[model samples]
Target: MKNLFFSVVVMGLAACSSTPPAPDWQLEAKGSMDRAVAAYLEGNSRVEAAELARARAQLSRTGRADLLGTAELLNCATRVASLVFEPCAAFEALRPDATPAQLAYANYLRGQAQPQDIALLPAPQRALALSAGSGAADPLPRLVAAGVLLQTGQASPAVITQAIDTASAQGWRRPLLAWLGVQARRAELGGDAAEAARLRRRIAITQGSAADAPKVLP
Candidate 1:
């Protein structure tokens, strides 16, 4: 939401500036990146794919592989938030051109961030890099922290609740169901079959199905 407006404002401001205007591809890349994340979180995989391809094309116009890596990181972060622990392969492929800061951020998102990488993390993540928040932090950071903790097997109860609440409050179906699946697995592992069943039912409802949640365990 915010990035779309920020990109437009950048172009507007640049138009009046005496200096060189920002290139069209730069603004287009930002817009595509914003749309791609939004689409992915909303479960619009087709839209997500199209937007990513568009972003890559626009970004490639700059001849900056580092910027392309940044786009991949943003995409990877959303997946992590959705409980998808896949490696950020595209970003990894760009490592030869990535800046030190970008490399550190990639590790941070992967839950392998060292103490030195903490400073390079985004501001929201930095505050929660070492500890859980009140589960009431702003949306984006809170979920990123939850994802990191979950990836590290250190997710606190508050963090999990925050992730679910954040997704629910924002009406983001994909991450909402993903977090619900997490709760379901935890319930199952704790021998709470009833709770697990209940969580699965909720997930099914959100997914517009009458059946139980698809195997969310593990």
Candidate 2:
């Protein structure tokens, strides 16, 4: 009887030892995302890419549906970074239960991918979709709406100028530079040399400030 009990105990211990422990996927995913954001803010593209890859890998291992939205957002951002304009499958497959802001951002990304598809929605509708912000949350949508309006030639230059000002005040570096370029071109085309020169100077100042800013890593 003692021999049989010993054998059973040994077998149980062996089985337990052979089984692999499950990963804490939630913590892994969060950590990877945090690192990715830090890398992006620090302008370390290689580290950002690696962190995003790690996040995707960790999310993939879990097989949890809840992580799908986050995974899709990361994938879409990656596509944008690579300048890949095709609509992201993950974004297109967003669940209907997603928040209004999420849906608006997804739509913006989709519009970016399909610039030639003009009939996606009217400019006003697009603007309305992105208009769900109060206080500091408003700059990105306003910038996106301004870009859309500029592309479609639906808004006056003043509207775009206001959007650019709002974005610049909020310290958005790249978008401000890009829109300033657009405005400079418009000024040149309209025979306003002084305005164009002023815009160019603004661009230079913004670029210099961006260069001087310290990068933050988490």
TM-score of each: 0.85, 0.52
Per-residue lDDT for 1-218 in model 2, tens only? 11211121121111222346534764566567666644543345677689878877876675543355545654454333222346657646655544443454455555542433223433433434344212232343455455545545554777657766865775655456666777788888999999989988887776674443322211
Q: lDDT of each model, Cα atoms only?
A: 0.74, 0.51
Count backbone overlaps in model 1: 0
lDDT, residue 91, model 1: 90
Clashing pairs in 1: none
